[model samples]
Target: MIRLDRDGPVWTLTLDRPDKANALTREMLVQIRDAAAEAEQAGLAALILTGTGKVFSSGADIDAARAGLATDGVWEEVSSRIARLPFLTVAALNGTLAGGAFGMALACDLRLAVPGASFFYPVMRLGFLPQPSDPARLAALIGPSRARMLLMAGQKIDAETALAWGLVDRIVPREALVEEARALAEAPVAAPEHIRRTIKRMIRG
Candidate 1:
């Protein structure tokens, strides 16, 4: 499930499946993709992705994955859309980020985490590989060695470690996470829209 809220130039998309740890189902992924598309069309200055309750996302739904209904392509598409958005994008990790959800967080232009938040990549443990774009983008942000530690060794790093490793731009208290993200978003609004969009495209490419 997803919830979209708009406040001035910022649009926030919240993963709303607390009972399931915000684990994404195929339908949820589709909804996210559609939401990203909508945000792009709306010409919003910033987009913030967050989750309800404690967990940011537990990744794809296991049952859906077992049935072959949830595929890497779906997540790849969603992350790609978010990456290509022509405005500032932020991943406000309210809690743990693991599995395919890591790719989504990595795709954002900025990442903010709460003090106890952590990052994990479980592909090696699950006997699967991440979407092709995931590793490259992740490595670009945190370097190849640390990326390997996460993707290959399944290392889970807490907020401070993530900040030191350059995985997150900032770590704020849980209650201040959203406010800090909003402030970051607001700061970019003074830049020319075209310049921001062009720079983001250049960086992503």
Candidate 2:
């Protein structure tokens, strides 16, 4: 389940599935897409994404994926739509990130992780290629060398190492993740739509 809350100009989208380590389902994906669309419509200045429990997310449930009831296919559309939001978006990484969970985190403009959190790319064992947009974002965040190390070698980096690689902007105690994220979200930015659109066009071009 996904929880949507609006605290003044801040919008918080929580992925609530602690029982399953916050794994996302197809319905949750639709909810996420709708949430992003609604936040855009509401003109939110900032958005925060987080999950409950010890794990930020365990990625997509393989059972659901095998059953063809997962959102794996629709994720690109959802992620692209989320990236189009004018507001600054932060992914509060409350715990370890891997698989589709990592993809979701990469979708955000900024990622704030907790100290105990880590990252892993396990797709190589499955013989599947990396997610397309993810590679570019990874490269932008961690640079070319680290991106290659992560994708080619399928290495997992701890929170500290991730920080060193620039994959994560800030690291804090698990308890402080939300507060830090909210503070960042509430901070001011130039939200000029035309400028943002032009910049986005140039980036895409």
Candidate 3:
């Protein structure tokens, strides 16, 4: 469900579920978390998350999420592992990032998006609550009002406005995102021990 490629200090994680628009399944979530743990142990400077096809992620597999909800605490347990990794997580949004898809990208410390990219969270349609982390991360990124608009109204914001709103750190041409993220990752690294623990603590805090 994920393909990991290491290039020096960067670890790129490609969502390998393109056939389903990268809809995340339970097993896929576990694989992603494991890769993040590995990246931290390997002293990688950062991790990049993206999808293989035009879509970044349509969100968690609704069918999967439905099946797991009654089982108690599945998504939280796994996504938290990836979210709290030692190295920085970068979501290289290739296209529309929607539904719980925002949660995965939100887990990232920074985001680099392409021109046509957009973000949305449509939890109401599924009759579920936002994982406690969503609102916090969204508010922190784009402020309370905008976060409310996006998360509650299920509004989708374009990449340019997302940059201006600070939801994304930067915007690049779609053709240049991977190279740009890798270059950005190279410069922001901290001493391994310091960066690793610091990022983990920050996310958890």
Task: Using lDDT, give the best candidate's number.
Answer: 1
How does candidate 1 score on lDDT? 0.88
For every model shown, what is its TM-score relative to the native structure? 0.94, 0.89, 0.87
Q: Over all chains combined, what TM-score does candidate 3 have?
A: 0.87
Give the C-alpha lDDT of model 2. 0.80
Ordered by lDDT, highest first, the candidates read 1, 2, 3
Error of 3 at 130 (Å): 1.3
Name the better of 1 and 2 by lDDT. 1
Model 3: residues with Cα > 4 Å off, grouped in runs: 69-72, 189-205
Comparing 1 with 3 on lDDT, the higher-scoring candidate is 1
Candidate 1, residues 147-196, lDDT tens digits: the string is 99999989999999999999999988889888888898876677777877
What are the lDDT scores of the predictions, listed in order?
Answer: 0.88, 0.80, 0.79
Candidate 3 scores a C-alpha RMSD against the true structure in Å of: 2.6
Clash counts for the predictions, in order = 0, 0, 0
